[model samples]
Target chain A: MATNSLPKADLTSSGRPVFLQNEIECSILSSVDLECDDIPNFPLLKSGLLVLTTHRLLWLPDNSSSSSSSSAAAVALPLSFLTHIFSTKKSVKTLFHSPRVRFQASLDSSKSVVMTVVMRGKGDTDAFLAKFWENWRARAWENDVQTQTQAGVGSSSVSGSGPGSGSGGFYTREGAVRMVGVSGILRKEQEMWESTDKSLQEAFQDLNALMSKAKEMVILAEKMRQKLLSGSNSKSSATNDDEVGSKEEMQDWLLSVGIVSPVTKESAGALYHQQLSRQLADYVRIPLERAGGMINLIDVYCLFNRARGTELISPDDLLRACSLWEKFDVPVMLRKFDSGVMVIQNKSHSDEEVFARIKALVTNPDTLRTGISASDAAMTLGIAPGMAKEHLLTAESKGLLCRDISPDGFRFYINLFPEINTDDVYLVKDYGIYNTWVRVASASRLE
Target chain B: MRRRPGIGGLQTAAAARDQYRLVGENVAKIRTDMMKEQLATFRTQLEEFARKHKNDIRKNPAFRSQFHEMCAKVGVDPLASNKGFWAELLGIGDFYYELGVQIVEICLATRPHNGGLINLQELCILLRQRKSDREAVSEDDCLRAISKLKVLGSGFEVISVGKKKLVRSVPTELNKDHNEILELAQAQGFVTVEEVERRFSWTSGRAIDALDTLLDEGLAMIDDGHRDGKRRYWFPCVSSNSTPVADT
Candidate 1:
């Protein structure tokens, strides 16, 4: 109840604090406490993660270390409310005691109180204080407000910015001369093309320039996607199949176009791999869902890099990031096949689900005779061919399937090795895939 | 409710499709332009990074592999031409190309016995023995070269058989019957026709036909001197404990 005095911070699925728009994390200090001696009912937040970001000071419970108090939620204090920071004094008494940074913040319009942050972990106190001061002075939240107003002014019609935009038609205005029908669409397309040409020209000016422009390009992509989305929904009954299909494709490309603040070595320093691993865990959830709870590491590398846009990490860095997941309590894991192929999969991913699908595939009458290849499983599983092959090989090892290699190429069939009665190869089981395969093969032969 | 089922409907449909196509073209153009820009910038940055850290990239095998991967994404083929800067700076191109040629030669030499199917571990040993330098060739290196050899056609491939990688250098086909027999022969180094028939629920004739095909292909051999008077067909290619590659 005392903790409710401070505003709560939202957490990602992987336990990372959900940052405000353009709020970049500056530094992280573990095992820190926020104490307010001025307020009687103030709860002394103890031994948690304190993150310094451009807009706020985030306190997240150390999920890995605190098993007993796992319910301890994260909280955020905006830098805008800070009135002053009490600098450390160089005294023998202070030197003996734990390093603490005190600051004055207003809880509401009437009450203002002094708060203390005691650092229990091994981190640079001076650097954290410097970043705190810098961030408080920088006031990055002001920029968000400016961009919000600008975006509002730019697209008065496209109010909803996310994937779930409302199904409002393009001609939704009342007083302004509205363009209707085909000519209106053509004019709108022409206007967008001119702006796109300008942005493209500006973006390609130089690499440094491109990096700065990446954010704008992502916004532009999102806006265009929203336009297409609403355009599709409003005209769903009037559009042709190819038009609807292509619009959906464009939406997909735009959806995966940004990761606003990707973790870089320059940003996270010694915690680079750790932070990257957490971010990757959150990033791969959507792609993993699309890929049936598993994806090849190589495919993830391409997708992650594409989303990151400019700050490309090496494969070694990616491997290290993925390997670090074992130390963190993330829902995703790094797996290595017996053949040395690596993949990122959800911890909840069950081989039995994949085996069941492969079982269905191989038992099909046509596939029962000719068998299925990695490509066949890839199409059905909605995963990469190499990943599908790994799944197939896993199923083979599990005795769910068997391999067939010949001029027709390497393929898999339902494993009849177990179902076979070695004592009498002539005897057919009344049940099992072997019997089904035999019946299908015999029927095909008869045909 | 907005359905039009006449001439005017067709016109509107055509106009809507045209508008969609126009918008789609613009979006595609923007996406491609953005991609091209990113790729170009990444290429320059990669070249600079490669130049500055060429020593680290060469000395560290993991770093070298990562560098190769980064180069691959930016449309740079460091191994394309040996006369270029990548060759002079890295020399990884010649290293893999030479290894590739040696792999081909070894595959050709061992074809008669292995039936063009050899264990990847065995192939790496042969490669190391054939070379005199202190430079070590790993299975990863061989795999990379083999991937590049894909340009040669469908004759070369790496197949996984019970946790073992077998490099197939010939275009021979092994159907379901042949694969099952090979798998059954994996245990105890060899299998009898009776075991194969009993295990696969196949008739004696079916088992013998598969075993005979494997024998004729030189992938297996018949050992008739058994105490029970039962013939054993041993598959050298599929056997894990056997080191027949040494004698071959």
Candidate 2:
């Protein structure tokens, strides 16, 4: 039973695929079968969901019986191996049966037939078949491989040429480079001008054209990041403080846009949300790790859509994809607060842990004296200010902390209410948390 | 002889049954009588105390002044002129038991140390005095005084009926030693003689005399720590080498 094969793909925690850095999904179909006559032991890859991507032919199981052994196996057929794609023939029999597109490809040394697939459920099947052919011929996976090699070679070559000689301004005829004053401003302007010019030109092209341009944009971002890194390294001795600051800012901007392949609705088709959801799950890993295991859904949407560039998904699509996380064995989950604010958090993200950290933060002598605002918590927690506010609010609800709303802003303090002896408000016992708070608060008042 | 019935068994069983019924009736009658006697005693004591103190309560300048002050502080009119007016206004009838218990406890606790038992009349006078003082006494302060009093004894008696209210102090033998009192005073941040007097209802002369004695004996001292003219008194329990005792 294990020897049988099916065209299937795995979904990420956010219901998106674990796609290669440059591999993009192309089409999706529900209630499809992978039938073959030659092999007797070939397990019936019964009515499952099939996905076509730029690089692989993927099949996923139907929603009803997804728990079966067949669904557990997701197989991919590399487009690089496909030698030919036979066009869909129009016949009376074809019209009667489910719409199927057959293609001939070389598996190892022999020619084999693989058919795909239109079990059209609320989607355009002919359109998907057309895209399937286009993606196969385009050979996006090959392009990614070639670009990676090109990037490797380019970096080595660019580094080999020292700063003095490599300074060929694409915007100006400055064969000679200067380090200060007007020349510095002119150089910075020229660099920005050329990059902006390239991106602008790419943006003006047709949507299909941008798919290829997106690769260049990714390459450019990577190059900029590398340049920033190397520049900081080489100029560490001579670089002034302001130059270093700007370099760091530029590096951050470049790093944010570094996602090479973002799944789009056009590519993922009817399984748009599911595939997008999976991709989102993979994407959120780094951000979630940096945010201490949780991130607001709105922030994820902005980051995801920004990384996606032109193929931004709707909020509804993002939500549906998040809602589907329960069905997959992903490491992250979608959490909704009582305030109706939603967030994507690691499955292991515990309130106890966050509350403990918050408790520590607010109880610090300095923080106790001057309560922490959302921004202050954001800086300390290394997360967005908005996200920090949500965490503080969560901690507040759990009674780990309390809020003080004042003209200055809303701030949080370690909750002393529970520890306080309301029966004796003035009685600060020497061996209790309330005593410590009173001491700290009094010290601040003196100051 | 074998066939004859035994008179000893029959007579003994009959006597035992009679004794059991007699005992049960006696128990019930005693419970009823005890309850009636307790009620009568409480009523008689209340009435006698009220009758004895009624003229003094009305004519006493200090009592009238204190009552007026309390009424003013609590936002009620003191000059209502009705006899039971204060009782009705303050809902003392409902709270009389609790207030009486508080007074008795305080008086008992403080009196064992030769601190005069503060009756309801004296408590009222002290509160009134504080109200008239530049620094007015808060309700919380009054309640604190009452609470401290309760720690002395199990039963603190108060009687409230119609417009008449009487409080009698019953001192107990559970007075704290001088060391403990000094510690409590320091912990409460009662530094100056005036502060101690205000907190414990000590006369100005008595508070000063005690402070002088404590300082002379070196058990306590007036530290040089003064803020806004309020000198902070320090107890020897807290090491002078450690951090200074802060106001808070």
Candidate 3:
């Protein structure tokens, strides 16, 4: 009963591994184990779900098989630390045994061990090994380190030029002599413009060139966003309203730029829908909160796709992903109303909360007199009009509200049906919404 | 290339300028495409980062507001037109517009018993029953379409009394006094002069005037069958359970 000493990987709320900045999941295999016989008292690395990414190999406990073993946590091994991967040998003896891929990796600066990955499940062992080799050779983690230093240099040079003028620093004359007179300032502006024009021309020579420069443009946009964010926070007292407003506009444009590493069928294969379901659960939390714990499935599709940029998922895929939520322990659920409207809602979202809000709305003197339309409830509840209507209907079904149909249009009022004393047609209760409504109605009469 | 004076020189200058402009436009287009691709890639990481710091981002009212602002900007009001991308895609605008016509038909058909004042729930049911498609027409849909009917005239507008909305298709304006009496009558499906006066502290004249007005409008019925000496001004329009079938 030896404890594992491997570094643990951080998992998302839905148990997906937290990926590095540019790390992408390349392949996945279930019921795989990583064993190091070279080290004594090695932890019992049992069959688990092995995820191969560009930067690391992540092993997560098979959720189905290890449901009761809470102690078996996910562990990660950086591909960067790998020294060599031994190719699988084709032999009669290998055919008799479970396919295994052995690799030599440095556990630390001073220690190295030969780790064997035992593939026990019905998976393409050869394919996993090929990817293991590809990822190890790709050296994706090196690229990340390079980008980090590059971004560091880029930002430092940006701040080093002068105090940023918010998003208007694009025309910043970095190395030119500090201009004094207006003519010198104009010359500096002209030179900056020419350099910008020349760079734009060079970047646009062809699509391939532009594709290569795309990463730089993204970094530039991110830098601008950071600049604006910091500018607003730091210079809030000194910035004029117009400058702040323009900076906000720039931030909006940059904020919508795009998302990365969407779970595609090409990458995740059989796990596409499951991973998508988890990714969706994580993505929808903010929007669900902003939408008051419930959002239309169609709306989520639109927002999720918009955030994902070109990696647009089909509505069918979206539905499959949503339906898969039931199998996971995610906090969100997909609900279909009686009218065939699909919605994703937080598990904690209660109809009673909405009902209570509707009740409060219907009892308002103005609402009591005029009733509330779906749009009225929508406005008050900060939800879509359609969703608000569904809530209003649910409230009506619960006898919390009643509808009025007229030439004026459809509206809802607090349900006075249950409060009425049917035994005595003229009886008015001493307390309740009905009584309060009656008082408001009568008071309006005198006015 | 520099500016020239001769006609041929001018032509060459114009051609050079045109070439430069074409390159500039090409670069702009390419830059935009690159930006979109880059943003798409960046968006995934940004969204993940945002999710991790969701609480902090949510607490930043400005961020939430900006997100909502974007949503608003992209949101198309399907009801705004019957022929547009949204209309063609979902046909929701047409659905509601057609539902509105069906609603009118139902109101007209049920006008006799309900007296142009039908409950929204009943209207939806009747509208559904009349349609062969029986397309799911919700009270909300009916409300949205009915609101659109306001353009027809003030005759069609939703009026609320007590805890119920009774659609009044007729042009008659039910003033505050009439609404008060209707709401008071809701509790017991009827109200007497004594109750109205006591509730409003109104003189008998004000109470009786409103009651008589409701009676003349065919909205109220005289229910003197009670053992008590007082006559109950029964508002069939405001009553939840008592069908107007008997009175009509």
Best by lDDT: 1
Residue A303 CA error for candidate 1 (Å)? Answer: 2.6
Model 2 misplacement above 4 A: A1-16, A63-72, A114-120, A163-258, A314-317, A324-329, A339-341, A351-447, B1-248
A1-447 per-residue lDDT for model 2 (tens digits): 323433445555444445666565556676676654543465556667676766787766555345655534555667776777667788898888777666655554644655444464655768867777777777667676687776776577447633333242322323544455434634544564555455635532543333335445444434444543454465333325354444355335324544445555554456666666667778889878875676556445545644443233555567787887777667888876543456677877666766777777777666766677654555465543444666888888888888887543466778888876778777778966677778887876898
Computed on C-alpha atoms, the DockQ of candidate 1 is: 0.03
TM-scores for every candidate against the unseen true structure: 0.49, 0.44, 0.51
The DockQ scores of all candidates, in the order shown, are 0.03, 0.00, 0.02
* Candidate number that wins on lDDT, 1 or 2: 1
* Model 1 misplaced regions, further than 4 Å: A1-3, A66-68, A156-256, A356-447, B1-248
The TM-score ranking, best first, is: 3, 1, 2
- What lDDT score is found at residue B165 in candidate 3? 67
lDDT of 1 by residue, A61-95 (tens): 87766463756678899998899998899899988
RMSD of each: 15.8, 41.4, 17.5
Q: How far out, in Å, is residue A82 in model 3?
A: 1.2
**Which segments of model 3 are wrong by more than 4 Å?**
A1-3, A64-71, A122-124, A156-217, A220-258, A352-447, B1-248
List, residue by residue over B1-248, the lDDT tens digit for candidate 2: 12335898777777776765554444333322332333233223223322333334333222222222222222221111112445335633212222322233234334544343333455666444422322343343345334333322222334332343333232111112233335445455346666676667664544544455345433355666665776656653333322222211
Which scores greater on lDDT, model 2 or model 3? 3
Which tens-of-lDDT digit does each residue in A208-242 have in candidate 3?
44345544544554554444444445433332535
